[model samples]
Target: MKYSLQDLIDMEHFQQKLIAVISKSGLKRLTEIEHRKQIEKSENRYRSILKASLDGYWLTDTKGKLLEVNDAYCRMSGYSEKELLSMYISDFEIIETPELVAQHMKKVALKGSDRFESKHRRKDGTVFDVEVSLQFRPEEGGQCVCFLRDITDRKSLQDRLESLWSLAQMTEAGPKVLFNLVLEKTQELTGSRYSFFGFINDAEDQLEVNAWSKEAMNQCRVQDQPIHFPIAKAGLWSQAVLERKPLFWNDYNLDHSRKKGLPDGHVPIKNFLSVPILRNEKVIALAAVANKDSDYTSQDVSQVQAFVSNILLLIEKRIADEALQKSDERLKLALDSVSDAVWDWRVHTGEVYFSSRWYTMLGYEAYQLPQNFETWRSLLHPDDLPESEATVFRHLKYAEPFEIEYRMRTKENQWRWILARGKAVERNDQGKAVRMLGTHMDITERKQSEMAQYPCQHPSNWYFNKYQR
Candidate 1:
């Protein structure tokens, strides 16, 4: 216990060194703990971002077997994470086979990173376009990190726009060429394996196939396939024409009621869709496409109907242009063959040419009144004047199709329904129609039939009341 002053100083120094060492060790441990907390926080943020991203994210081995998938990927694929992990790339790769998928994986591994566009099939068996961004991370045991974005809508819009442009360019082409273009565009826009565009005969009993899909032509084995066929023989698919409505049959295979109309070796029909192109409630033409990879929906019907409308516009223009280039005698001859009555109006001179058939169709003699625009105008019923006049001027001014239905006064003082169709055959430098040629078909019987079907719905009944009054 009794010690010198120097001994006490030396003992105090030793105690101070021990305290310093302990303090340093504790500070170092605290710093290490803080670093670990920062790393964990960073990892949590990364995981949250990966989970919330709208684009699908997945990690797969070099062999194309999915190892991990995010919720977005699961939703995009219509499968759960566990289901996706159990599937390989070839299970849903539509554009490639298993061999092709393996080759693609090899290319990605060699390149380290790549971006490409491809199609993928969902669990529900519908296909969609995807943009894949992949990175081969050798550091992470050669696992591939991939991201996919759904581009189905974008790709559809782009294809539709391109189709429209192509159709517009082909408007001046003849009817055969134009119809083929339309059919091709329809198949592309709808993703159908086969398609056809056909015009209904005037009798509404036969369908004349004007254009057909190239795929159908290639796969079909029928010798000398019939270009025209009776509507009754078209089986259930003809309902679109007979019923004057659109038809969709998604499960064509399971429907035993579908008549056996396919010839031997015909391409098997998995699904079918037909949209009637209507004019004044009459099915003048129809477009049908078959065997899309998935079930056809109402959206497809709408798209086809819209496309048909554009096709009609182009067709009207083509007919007008062709008629204008023909001789008057030739044009008259052609009109006489197809129309019950014909009219030619000279816009600048206000003169009109009425065929003898026109007078007879109205129960009048030749030159009964005056062969002028006034004669046609006066015969139009009061209820139909505004729309009839607008349709005529619209075609003259805007080059729109001249097609209208109205009641016209016959010589017997009876109102007869007339389906009037025409075109502006000649236009001046100002783009105004200089001459218009049109045909008239008496459709009183058809109007009466429609009225009999639904008296309250048909406008013909309203016209009859006005005529009686």
Candidate 2:
């Protein structure tokens, strides 16, 4: 059997042998044939891989004019294959300019590759985010190949994550302010005219709006006040709360059989989404967005889920902090209303907060006394320092009740008897004293009275008699 030249060339066997044939021919014609075959094989391989990619791919020149495009790119750009071939990369880059491209090319030249995020315009003029990874193909006339992935959803998720991080860092913000921040960030995310995050009233029948977007307040609230309603209503958010799941509606006006209608002064809505903020498998709060220019989607619900988690965390922290602060205030008030001087010391840091009574008891104005451990130590008579320090160390180490008598120097530079009484008020995880609260009472008059009643037995009587001389 004989084989024709074309048949032999078409066979896979002949193609494999072409590698050897080209090298042996060493002539320009055979070399060109080999080169053409190699180019065809490369193109086939490129098309098979790049066209099948989920991301778009584009090959362009240094001037940005498109040299080639994969099927995905043509679909993404909303352009036909022929039309895209005639366009420049700039035509689709909504946020990038010639100068930016030039700068990007410079980096690509130095690094041989670069990746960045930018917005791209489709043929119909809508814009979305894209992450482009560009590689320089130096072999081909300053050509560059780009791998493009649509990152609109990823960018939105990242923005929500960043908002969460910012809110987490703002632990000092008041609860009201933090709630408003949640609404604002969510409003921007959903592109809604109104956003609401609120909890159910104790009755479980009323949903109280804790936070509302400014637009929601103006349009839906009563006189710029929060707007909430009975859970009995069949509104989108109410249904979400009752069902304990997310609900989305694109056209509420079209529904006639729904159990609820728009409330008085409520903003008219084209579309809305509502999701439950559940804790321990129970609905604790509801997050809702309404009157978005576009329709509400399931994607919007998922996005708000992330926001809701962060919001709940911040709210829980704020509530705990507020309770602690109130408790602190009550304790301080109880200590302050007394006639005795008070001092609360943070044992770990050596910081002291002295009450105003402490200054007045020593015959000085409130501002005259310094709030420091060293200041307290300086006011102690040198004779009292050793016993006072020893008592404090024993009390801190053993949780022993601290009650001792010491001579404290007054503002007049006179030694006065004081009953120093205190106990460790707080402790660290290792059972070490971290805070201590105590009181100082001026006992000079009592000591003098005792000395008069029993002059022989009182230790200070001889000193008193010597001073009298």
- The global C-alpha lDDT for each of the candidates, from Candidate 1 onward, is 0.86, 0.81
Model 1 residue runs over 4 Å out of place are 1-16, 60-67, 86-114, 134-145, 202-206, 214-234, 242-245, 256-266, 328-469
Clash count for candidate 2 is 0
> What is residue 21's positional error in candidate 1, in angstroms?
3.5
**lDDT, candidate 2, at 112:** 88
lDDT of 2 by residue, 298-406 (tens): 7788888888778778888889989999998887778668989899999988999888788878778885867889888998877779989999999999987799998
Instruction: Give the TM-score of each candidate.
Output: 0.60, 0.76
Top TM-score: which candidate number? 2
Winning candidate number (lDDT): 1
Deviation (Å) of 394 in candidate 2: 1.7
